[model samples]
Target: MKHLNTFNNTILYDFMELFHSLPYTFLGMEKSKDAFESAKVVLLPVPYDGTQYPYKGAANGARAIIEASRHIETFDDELNLELEDLGIYTLDELEISLESALETIKRVQEAVEEILDNKKMPIILGGEHSISLGAVRAINAKMENVSVLQLDAHADLRNEFKGCKYAHTCVMRRINEISHYVGVGIRSMSKEEKEFIEENELDIYGTNFNSNEILEKLKDKVYITIDLDVFDPSIIPSVGNPEPQGLFWIEILELLKKIAQEKEIIGFDIVELSPNSNKISDIYAAKLICKILSFSFFSKF
Candidate 1:
């Protein structure tokens, strides 16, 4: 009995060591199950928060989201299918330098181009909303006409913020220069941003309207970016920037389902989650990813 106990303990030690050595992956899945070549979706994690201030923990978001994803059930009851069967490849986190935001975006753009070239749909997990700029730039290079659909609490249409044109607060402003955009769930914005929207007659579907109105304005190919702060603080309180009277879970999901049915969703990012001690935000972010992926891949609408 003593000899058997010793052998079991040795085996457990070896197993734990091997587990610790494995590369981190979304859903904690083995590489063999989700190989890059076979995958339909590729997850690019950009764990950078170079420009965020006050609440600055978004850099940890990618790691937290991936870690929490490991525990979710793979089967989707709404879709009535195992969405995991559609292979999801989680790449190593993008190594971005904090000193140069320009260089970081350039790196991200190049990486996204490579992912597209490989014919995989890219799902970016961001360090901040600014990261979407590079990914959107990459998408624009491949397709001649593309539109961006942003679901966020803030307009993000500032020309510049805090002396930096490339700050997260100005992400949509930068994107508007790249391609046309439609802003949804926006409850906050600066006076300048509001002026830009009104002057240009930009299509903004705010809390006052249902998301279905978004379908008419979007182009055939759309890149969707969701700032997690778009949700009410009650549901997800860990975001760097929180606004009151934001969209709830069901409302957002219903909108996404409609969009998936109506247009081709080329790529997307879920950003601005700053994990707390409870880790509930991380799990919510992960589930959001899974649900969106399932709907995008399998839904008729």
Candidate 2:
């Protein structure tokens, strides 16, 4: 329902360094029809961060990441190649009114299905952790054997919560309906979720669990879903739910690198970053997306 404001537009302009005198898109380049579709990877931004426990504004997560992306160097110093070589595509956000979360999830599911049907991997930036439900369903529409790699502070496996069956608390429970998954860096869990896991014999590795054990359990083609709360609050305090202690940025990077080395990451989503005017969190989220994209390519090479 809310679009970019003038101040936000000005910020985007400065970051992109574009010649506004001429008609151009975000990166100050012409929209490449062929190059865009032929792209191996696609970025989908869904600005619908609803159903929060602590803070609000994760709805702004997509815009914040896209804005900060302008500051990203096209040529990766670490990989020593232009990311454009992989043919990245960025789409305008699909329509959503933010009135109902369930309706938004259905819309997301449709958009995600289109991406998967095209045979291109989708990197969805979240409005909330609930957005993962649509992405998980999107993958299920086509793949025979798919597994989710959830990196979060809490186990989002509740069958229902807050009188909402499709609450953010129930995202993983919905994913469980379609396929198996591996949960990593989990430091929060409820008694109900614990019983559900024990009874179903699910693949869950808590914060106390070993990374190596979880890595080996992943399937060949995987969909990764990250709730930003997985990071220690000291490191990423701007998320909706700030858990005291969790994984470090580099530790997550290393974990992703290991997963990329071992499995094919079909899709991913980074949810629950509520940006502030301070701007550090925005750039951090952007860098995280860029790093994951780079890792995805570097591992294959």
Candidate 3:
């Protein structure tokens, strides 16, 4: 019995080694021929988190999500499509800038601009929410009448936080300067953000917001920024901030499906996943990215 157990363990080890030896792309898929030229979607992993806060591991979130994605099945039963055929190209992780958050954001903006120039949809995997401003900046510069759809627990409307104007907490404020934005799944914010929302009559919605109302506020072109904390801690507890009573899986998916069916998603980012002992959170984040892509590209309903 002991020898049999040893053999089983050896086979398992060999299987894992073979799997790891494959090309390290999202979903462990083979590299596409002329990936950059033929691909309709380009994924940019931005591993950066410069926020001065206790939750410091978000810098590793992008890699974690990619690793978790390898275990997911490539076929989506709901969409009835194989994602691998979509020519989704995963670019090398962006070189992070240590100078400052603003500098990092600038680097992100440049990378996203290049992706846009290629005429492919950009899906940014975030190290933190602040990285989203870079993509938003790039999209706003090229597209007109663009509206940002923010899905997060916090309003992130602060002008500045911890002396950093470009910190993750203040990302939406900076975005407001470039294009109109609607905030949804928001359950927390500062008095300043509340006052600002009221003053501007911004389309900021709580957890119970109607999807139709949120869609009406958006223009034809929409850039979505999803902070993982917008999900209930019960579903995804590994984030920089875990607020209570957040949106559940099916609820958020329904809303995303509606948005994908209606709005023209110019670009999107998923951020603020600080990986921890709970491996489920990492897998959940990866699946969320896949579902979003599937909805945007292949959803019939």
Candidate 4:
């Protein structure tokens, strides 16, 4: 058994060398193909799930999304463009200890601030919805009047949940404190959140609401935060919380395309994918990320 293990390691080493001489990045991109210094887009993996509830494994979301991206075709059919030339850099995953959610937010904020400082568009892959808080906070510091467009099953408007102000359940509430946002696919939330949304007269579109109407409310510069559970559970069941009668694949793409054409998507994050043994949801998440990136690339040039 020991000899067989050694042989396997040797073969793996040889294969890696033959395939890639540099560190791993999204889409299995070698260092030369997507150097950080020249890349227009950056993929930042935040694999921290300190505030998740009802499901655990969301901390592995970034790893699954990156692995699944390896299979994405470089050519985008919808836009009739090849996005590979744009230089997509996948930074090493953020080093996170199992700390309090506040500490995690600080770490993510610092990393995102650096990415913004470099003048690159940051695409964050999340461990949970709470991670978006840090990215949003960082972006808000740099860009004025930043509005968040949230795609999720829940409003996530709790001031605090499970005694943690930075809990995944309260992410949007924290975000709202800093910047204005519009919520879509919000079919689930507590009474308090519902009241909060109503009291504030927030611009939120329900699951059955028109997707196109979101365009009118969004600001010139928008940051998109997608929680995978916004999709019907039949298609993306491996999320932190699954809600039925959610948005479909095509509808989401159409909305994103429209937004890309009209609004400047400064940064975005896809979070809350609690991947199971099945690769189905992971692949879906990766494809969604790729589509958004493609649309974003087209918007720029």
Candidate No. with top TM-score: 4
Model 4, 278: alpha-carbon shift in Å? Answer: 1.7
For all predicted structures, in order, the TM-scores are 0.91, 0.87, 0.91, 0.92
Please list the C-alpha lDDT of all candidates, in the order they appear: 0.87, 0.79, 0.88, 0.87
lDDT of 2 by residue, 32-112 (tens): 788666688777888886676656798888878777777667677987767767776778876765677788888888988
lDDT of 3 by residue, 70-97 (tens): 8889899988988888877888899988
> Cα miss at 12, model 1 (Å)?
8.7
All candidates: CA RMSD (Å): 4.2, 5.8, 6.0, 3.6
Q: lDDT: which candidate is best? A: 3
**What does the lDDT come to for candidate 2?**
0.79
Write down the RMSD of candidate 3 (Cα, Å): 6.0
Count clashing pairs, candidate 3: 0
Model 4 CA deviation exceeding 4 Å by range: 1-23, 32-34
Which model, 1 or 4, shows the larger lDDT? 4
